[model samples]
Target: MIIDTKKLQKEVLENKKNHGFNTTDIEFELLRLYGETNELFEAWRKQDKENIDEELADVGIFLLGISEMLGSGLGEDITNKMKVNRKRIYKNRDK
Candidate 1:
């Protein structure tokens, strides 16, 4: 499915407004994003597929909302970054 990030961003912001979530504080958003990532990590560590998916979506949702709050296009930024990455060379890191 094709995802419309602009529309999703707007919807995310609207949901935040409806739920009375923090919309103006970038720091708070970043902290929330960090927490979501930690949750995602915990889900992965537990090998819980269901919770893993939910936490992954939560991370993406926070990212979309933060992009909207910053007046940035998350989709466009990703596309552009991908293009740059494609042209770059990288070495595999040891695990």
Candidate 2:
């Protein structure tokens, strides 16, 4: 099923509120996102499939929460970025 990222972002914000989590600290969220990314890398290095997917979800949750805090539509941003990426050429592709 196709996920509704905008709805997910709203749910993340609501969950943060319900849990008394940081809803206004972008820097803290960024740091936590970095930590989550590290965890994802470690999981990949260990070839732990379950943990890998979990860590990835953690990273995505942080990102969606951050996007909510910043009042950005993550879905739209990703779609636009993908369009830009599709039009770009990598000079190092032959290397």
Candidate 2 stretches with Cα past 4 Å from truth are none
Which tens-of-lDDT digit does each residue in 1-95 have in candidate 1?
Answer: 99999999999999999999999999999999999999999999999999999999999999999999999999999999999999998789576
Error of 2 at 53 (Å): 0.6
**Which residue pairs come into collision in candidate 1?**
none
Q: lDDT of each model, Cα atoms only? A: 0.98, 0.97
Q: Give lDDT tens digits, candidate 2, residues 1-95.
A: 89899999999999999999999989999999999999999999999999999999999999999999999999999999999999998686865
- How far in Å is the alpha carbon of 87 misplaced in model 2? 0.7
Badly placed stretches (over 4 Å) of model 1 are: 92-95
